[model samples]
Target: MDDLGVTVSAGSYRSTDPEAVHFPHRWSDEGVAVQAAFTGAHLLHLSAAGCVLNDVYREAQRLGVAVAGVRVSATGDFDTDTWVSRGITYSVEVDSPAGADDVAGVLEAVDQVAEIPRAIRAGATVRRVPAAGQE
Candidate 1:
């Protein structure tokens, strides 16, 4: 089977607050070695939202609809027991000159075809291999 791969590098610690320069002193002092600039859960939501936004634009173009802007927000609850996401939700707002029915149709089509959500719903197997020089 053909496999697709993506790689990301770890980032240093960062503050959650927009204005803060760094995480609070207490968290920094706790000797947390595996800190990340952003959490994995947040990245998952971002991926979904980004896919939806891009699909919306692509579908609108194909349908000959003029869109001014698109906004999508996604959130999900993580189940501690299962270590998996539960009840993911996303809200989409599109600024367009098209009729309401046309806009709605575009959104619905995008929802059906967004890749990340489709992958999650269909389920994909993930395997880890050691990085070069690690083993």
Candidate 2:
């Protein structure tokens, strides 16, 4: 995540970073840690990582699995000339006290329901509308 990717870590895996943007999280008292530059590309990846991290906690609770931490990393590249995204890929790591199988089940469930990742996977049409006062 140094140059080509973005990472979001929460719970026990979260490293203290005063500069990182923190958001309240239900599973983690310290919330989530965002370590990424403010750029279109980084923001794009951050969206995915953030979604996955949240889903991990959500699914864990739904499945009655105990999760201590979660870290999600997302990476992608764009066609330099056109600036079209090549693709985005992400991985999730969970620190848990539950059995491996239980955690795995939660991860699998999150993968199926993580909204941002699913949206990116299916793609979407973008449309622009002028401001109410101007054309």
C-alpha TM-scores of all predictions = 0.70, 0.91
Looking at candidate 2, what is the lDDT of residue 124? 72
How far off is residue 46 in model 2, in Å?
Answer: 0.6
The alpha-carbon RMSD values of the candidates against the true structure, listed in the order shown, are: 12.5, 1.9
Question: Which 10 consecutive residues of model 1 have the lowest summed lDDT?
Answer: 1-10
lDDT of each model, Cα atoms only?
A: 0.61, 0.88
Candidate 1 local lDDT, 1-135, one digit each (tens)? 111111111112222333322222221232112111256776676667667766877788888887766656677767777868774577777777799999999999998999988887787677899999997
Most accurate candidate by TM-score: 2
Q: Alpha-carbon error at 38 in model 1, in Å? A: 1.5
**lDDT tens readout by residue for model 2, 22-51:** 888877999888888889999999998999
Q: Which pairs, if any, clash in model 2? A: none
Model 1 clash pairs are none
Q: After superposition, which runs of candidate 1 have C-alpha atoms over 4 Å from their true positions?
A: 1-37
